[model samples]
Target: MPGRTGARHAVVRPPAAGRTAAPVAAGLVLVLLVLVVVRLPWVGDLGMHAATVQRLRHSPLDPGNPLVDADTPSPYYSPWMLLLGTVARVTDLPVFAVLRLAAAAGLALLVTGVWRYVKTLSAHRAAPALALLSLLLLWGTTPFLWSGFPGLHSLALTVSYPSTFTLGLAFHFWAWLTRAVRGAAGWGVWLGLGALWAVILLCHQFSGVVATAGAVATVLAARPRRTAWLRPVAGLSAGAVVLWAWPYYDFFALFGAGDGLEPVHRVLYGHPVARFGLVLLGVAALVPRWRRDRRDPLVVFFALGVLVVGAGWLSGHYSWGRALPAAVVPAQLAVALEAVGAGRRRLRAGWAALLTGALLLGGWAQAGTLGYVVPRGALPQALEDRYRPPWTGYHWITPWVRYGDVVLAEGRPARQIPAYGPYTVAPGYPDFFLPDEERRTKATGTYFAERTPESVRRGIEREYGVRWVVDRTGALDGTGLRAVARGPDGQVLYAVP
Candidate 1:
């Protein structure tokens, strides 16, 4: 894509116009790698996303259900994921390996994006370095990696849920910097639309509302030379078509619809307090400087983006993944704008130091959380959703299901779990008549609170060929059920004799 090439050309230019200062930019990227050290954010949503992409290799064009269909189940992401999926299907890349690759790609995109935009304005060989450095610093933070990590692993629309958000912001910033660099009198609505449309679709159809507001905000806040709609409309259409054609969206929603299962998109992904602070800082930084760039529309565009995100959350469910790109993209751009405009060398240097410190501190704090106590608290399910241990998913799962435990048992991800690999939990409900592959293979029986349906109890009895049951204990409640372990959450045991 021209986007990638453009950034490279700009950064690798001849040293004539204060150009050869790539070291600083490289340094920035190195420092921001704190998250990698902590292993805070797994690239590619880590396992599940890689699992889905790998599953689709055998069967493509699935229209049934994204989550249920192993071929293309990742609904939260866009279709671009299939590119990797194809590789998985053909070459047999392990899910984790694919995730690492995706993560690396995402890093490359973000770096290139920041470099090009910053290069447009920076001179003295240090400008691109400074801008690149700032972004690197931001990425360096643990929280930032956690927040942005999804962009790599999630397939289009699915992963783009967050990537688009980030990409949208990056797009807007790029447009702003392009205008500033090109020395054009006005911003181009057309260039901005290229990413905006994709962002809207990526965020979900509702994000269109946010996109609309951003258009108005840019017009109101930033002065642009041309207001032509044709070019923008055309670009937007193309991007949208690309997104629509991807199979990730096609299968997940249609075939897999159910009452209880929730897509990760429905829930907010960031800590409320933490995200709120980020929001406030963005506003504080941008608003105060708006008057200075009153003629520049990025400020107003940012304001509108913020409002829509907050409002979107209040009116409907809020996903931090959806709102973050809008906030961080502008916030970082504004920082660059301020530093670039500082005029005095000393002031620019000082501001740069302070900003770098803040970002690094944030990154440090983010990484620190993962050190010891956080993992127990931060499992995606612990803070954000309810999660049950995988059926037949304990350490001892190896004891029963030989080929594999009941895990890798079902779903689009399950098929890829190596045949008979009980590693992944097989489904439980919706068919009490049939045992979840894991439990069946492991000879494990289901026991739950009052919620356990009679049919399920009967199914348990039938499948295990036992009498008597222990609903109170975690173990098989069959006639052989026996007491083993007990806790406030529940009890443990075997089938009672």
Candidate 2:
């Protein structure tokens, strides 16, 4: 019913920037991130973590969940992982549910990083709209913006939580590197970051490498200013030095073995080409960007990281996770360059179009993963269809829970925790095998850590308010715990005294 003149204007001119409807795009990105975390983590390794937690409480002295090393310092190597198990038992929440929440939070932080970077560059302009647009645009790219969700396929079809963490570190590194490249006093940031990278390498080795490399590349790309090359060489050299030492030993010391020199394959640098395509394309994208913002170190660091990591992946030394950090930079950068200037308008428009295309393709695949989303510490009560038993119906007892080690039992059976069963024979738990040090590493039994076996046992007894040991698993034969319960296909759950 509008007048022809008003209608004519609608066709003649796009709505004013103020009159333009606000995009639901950013909200959609967040929603997608949440959904991805829920669905993918539910099906991913988080289940294993939860199962491990359940076993600890269900069988405090069981060898499978050993705290003390039967032989080494500790029986199991996943001490950091056990913290989550403890959290699961202490809060009585589902472990996977908690993991999902954490993943979602990381995704939010990444979005914040991009928004902050954009504002830093254009604080005087319409930062809010630009920030929101940048975020939405980045979120739209596949393999570029990982969303850090469990199953959200960001470019490269790579997946994992540490990937997002690496990306976050990349943002911080870019800021400092840019200043450093410009001859600004920014060595402190690089040094501090390198130390932090060492810690990350210890926990999730690949993440550290990707973060370090990506940061350096972004720095160089940001300004590409030739500054004695000493800055980057020194920063990267420190990281290399750390990688060569620490976990193993000082590399130089190994050569003094007189008659020894072991040519061990570097596990990290193993895969190279497989990770190159996305990396190469990203770097290629930046070829023209150098003129737009020659001072931004983030672009340089990201470019180099991607190229080098991609080369590593192809060489069979790189892992997908290691390359993940670098890919996300281009995702954000593409959005950042879109509003540069008039001459570059078409190029920016094409970049936006291409990113939009990639996102549409990824979204098509993500459609299948929407329903499986569960939190880290808890599962939905309506598992009337999810699991078989022992692992199913368990949800009714607690709103949130974690998973523990899943054991597979073979022939003969074995000794187990007292809470896990009625023990009368030598094969029975708590009475059969002695807790040996060598066996601690090899033994499936996981009771107390060598550090505080007595303490942990006592604590377990006190925490659960039970004098009896409860070993819960599906295996038996050796001194391993037996499965007292099971799923329909015959997956059994054992117990001990």
lDDT of 1 by residue, 456-485 (tens): 655655544433222333333443345443
Best of the candidates, TM-score: 1
Q: Estimate each model's TM-score.
A: 0.59, 0.53
Write the residue-wise lDDT of candidate 2 on 104-141 in tens digits.
54566555665555443433233334334443333321
Q: Please give the RMSD to the true structure for each candidate, in Å.
A: 9.6, 12.3
Task: Name model 1 segments beyond 4 Å from true.
Answer: 1-45, 63-77, 121-129, 132-227, 243-284, 295-297, 313-316, 345-350, 369-447, 450-455, 458-473, 477-497
Model 1 has an lDDT value of 0.42
Q: What lDDT score goes with residue 53 in model 2?
A: 44
| Residue runs of model 2 more than 4 Å from their true location after superposition | 1-23, 35-40, 47-101, 118-163, 176-191, 222-284, 290-303, 306-310, 318-321, 324-328, 339-347, 373-483, 488-490, 494-497
- Model 1's TM-score against the true structure: 0.59
C-alpha lDDT of all candidate models, in order: 0.42, 0.40
